[model samples]
Target: MPVDQIPIGTFSRITHLSQKALRLYDERGLLVPAARDICTGYRYYTFAQVERGIRIRHLLWLGFGLSEVEAILEARERGDAGTIREHFARRLAETEREIGRLHAIAEVLRTQDPLNGGFRMSITEPVIKDIPATRALSRRERGVYQEAIPRMIGEICAYVYPADGRQPAAKVTGPIMFICHDEEYRETDADIEVALPIAGSVNLDGTAIGVVTLPAGRFASVLHTGPYPGVGKAYERLFAYMNEHRLVPAGPSRELYLNDPAEVPEDELLTEVQFPVEDLPLSP
Candidate 1:
């Protein structure tokens, strides 16, 4: 009833925050009422609290949780710009990851077949073969799944094959292979290695590239002939085959690029997906 205090209804209208939310915030000690009527138990807010309420609403709209808003407000009260900047940077990165996940979900929906109640792509049996060990030059980088593989491959090729009439120092032995080190699907910071088998040793002292030798082993592999996004279907079949046959994986999985994306359409791109397998256990 005091002239200085505004009732909860009027405060909610002014701040654009629902009355229920204000009560919850008060209960959580995020924003306490400026005054409370002892007899009637009515909540009231002072004019000064109007700015704080509006700031909380704006932060909520910006996708910040109540705890995050509290931290930011506390930082602001302490005049700590560095903490505020750090919080904003972290929120930005989280938003980016969420966006990436949403995009991946959209891709799955677009590829699904409603009529058959299954995915549109079909997975075939993989060929089993023994692979020989080889030495190669490799470049490892942490990046997102789709964009990193092609970009790293281009960088390696540019280093090995220069356009200026200079002879190449190293001889490329076989198709480029991508070794996936992540145990599961990751939208960001996925560990990937791009390797090119080289016939001779090449100096990589000053660059990010290094020399690596791939161990010879038996592998189960399938030819994935389509866009990269749909290659998961091939992996599904390959893993299912391994599980059904009681074959255990021995090393990191690899993808041999049989054709260049720049030279062919996405649907025509060929990739040989290979998983190194341990030998079947001797019969008990």
Candidate 2:
């Protein structure tokens, strides 16, 4: 209540925080008391400390860690405007990323309807075309019924598109897809390629793996958009489509990369979902 000091309980009240939380903050060096009585050893916070406590509470609400909050507060105390500005910029970037993820979630929810469900599967006859033997700067991973594969594909795309001077072409084409090297989990080694159709040999550091001639055939293809978990649902729809049409997939289902991770909105990622297959013969 006084200018020089206030009771811990009063400080907690002014800061709108629980005593337990206040104590934790103090222990974490987030908000230390201004003084303590020698005999009673009771914590006392200066009136100014109340304002700092309130600031800490607000920073915590913004998802800053105690250390981050302390650093920001220290910068303020030192009148270091540049450090404050940098912290805010970093916070803004983090906030934007969080918003992007939430927006992707919202988009998936909106597209869950049958009319525009997450996947569009269609069957077509085999056709032949000449595709340039292109080099892909890829990163491979084990996808076996795991969500990590999708992220690996994205990281690969991000690495290639921006770092390799291939981003411009990435804007024109489709959603990214995965190329499965084996059947299901039997061949546990899943090598996913983030392919960009380049004109010539691009100096890439990772293993080239091998060339896959995507044979043109009667295939059931689906377009999967959005992030990892959402793509799983799309794969489900593809399987359902095959079941409904009595189609038997002839070869390993492969994903065709159509968007650069660095440039495309992850929600709107374009992937050509291709499955080599043959229609089940009509029963006599």
Candidate 3:
């Protein structure tokens, strides 16, 4: 055979694809032979087919089945660049999201501080501010930490409006840290509430629950990026900052979720960690 011409066997050898797979590709119109021998019905591949064969093999290595590879290659052949671009873009977005979720889970696993091996004091600065009173058509439940939040958020959205529409104006509270106000039991029994904060004159159940007056108080706030489990470290950092500045929390720490978990990237979660503070330097 000429250097420019390659037999199917030669192509298969070079591409590390089985001859059977090459035949399947040809049958599927994925990679057809450049020329066919009239006398023997043999298929002769060109040097160009070698590249396509290699690409098929590569896609297979990446865990794409033959059918998906054919769809992608066919899109390219039809000169539909948009379809190909969209395919890769969607894959990229999915991979990024998976990576973010993995990071978040890992952070959750490694949350225990090696030095202390227990919860310790965390504090921050004092800044006077106002948090408007709001009501939530809220639901409370006790369940697994990871699963409870997302489901409740969904329920709140459902109660407010259509699930298919854009999210209504709202704020998610943190202090996501839950405690047993009644008793200390296993982690499973912890009281968890997902509150949706909304503006004035809100009717959750056609009447006011009560005006939750968020007192005007000083607070030290920090931005925590990534998933909830990763927040322990950020909280630790905040505690260090507070202690270094000689500040004490005047009230319970408040977590204001700045990003929605449903849409925001897991690793890029924006959580504002606000600790009510008493001793903060007065601005000049």
Candidate 4:
């Protein structure tokens, strides 16, 4: 029993670290005891180790892993500022990512509320409208529905607003539209076309965008005002109208984004969901 060595009990009381934790730290070589009685096999700590004990507890409280705490302690002992900074920087980034993930989860939970969720019944009535034919700069791709649509829109904007103040190649006449060519519901690998009508003379000489002349047709249309997920109700209404009026789909359906999503909140987004249709003859 050295005069400098304090029993584990006394050390635990002074440092506020549990005896079990002190023993675990000793086993991990994170903070070894100052001495051990050979006869009793009891551990004792020195006052010099108290600061390190408090530091280890504080680091653990900050959510640092045991391994990370050990590395940080060693770096502090070496007076290596850069190593300490690197560890903190990494932890900060991890915290930010965790925050973002939690926010996404919260949003999902919020949208599940029956009365206040993101969904709403269709407020606008379905109508049969004549959609005029027009030439559009379009890009077709196989991917997730409208997930990659923004990227396609950016590609078109880049050519229209062409790089570095160069003369514009085309004039955008209408809002962005996404055409769904699939006949049935699909989870992935969907056939889609993203297009923007252009009325003025245009040149897509070197651009990957191909010119598409959107066909004129009578479409059953419904304007949906809310998040894209709420558009399902519009489709529900459209199909019901079709069934009641004995109308059949003539061509693929399309979504016309009437306003810039970036400029409006999710609840204010305006999208016209349309399906080309033909009237069924009266049964004799």
What are the Cα lDDT values of the candidates? 0.85, 0.63, 0.63, 0.84
Residue pairs with backbone overlap in model 2 = 126-217, 126-218, 174-258, 175-258, 175-270, 175-271, 178-255
TM-score of 2: 0.52
Question: Candidate 4, residues 49-135: lDDT per residue as tens digits?
Answer: 889988998888877999999999999989999999999997886676567557645664676547734464344889999989978
Evaluate model 3: give its TM-score.
0.43
Give lDDT tens digits, candidate 2, residues 1-284.
Answer: 35788887887789898889887887888787888778887788887677777888898898887778889998998999999888888788667766866876676676654654553323233332233333444445554323445566556455545766655423323344566766555433455444333344344456343223344556676666655445555566777878887878777666775666678766656666667777788999
Task: Write one digit per residue (lDDT tens) for candidate 3, span 199-281.
Answer: 54544554222224344566677776665655666667777777878777676555667767678765567667767666756
- Clashing pairs for model 1 are none
Show the colliding residue pairs in model 3. 127-218, 127-219
RMSD of 1: 4.6
TM-score list, all predictions: 0.68, 0.52, 0.43, 0.60
Model 3 misplacement above 4 A: 1-144, 164-186, 206-213, 280-284
Cα error, residue 197 of model 2, in Å, equals 1.9
The RMSD of every model to the true structure, in order and in angstroms, is 4.6, 9.0, 14.5, 9.8
> Highest TM-score: which candidate?
1
Report the C-alpha displacement of residue 114, candidate 3, in angstroms. Answer: 14
The count of residue-pair clashes in candidate 3 stands at: 2
Worst 10 residues of 1 by lDDT: 115-124
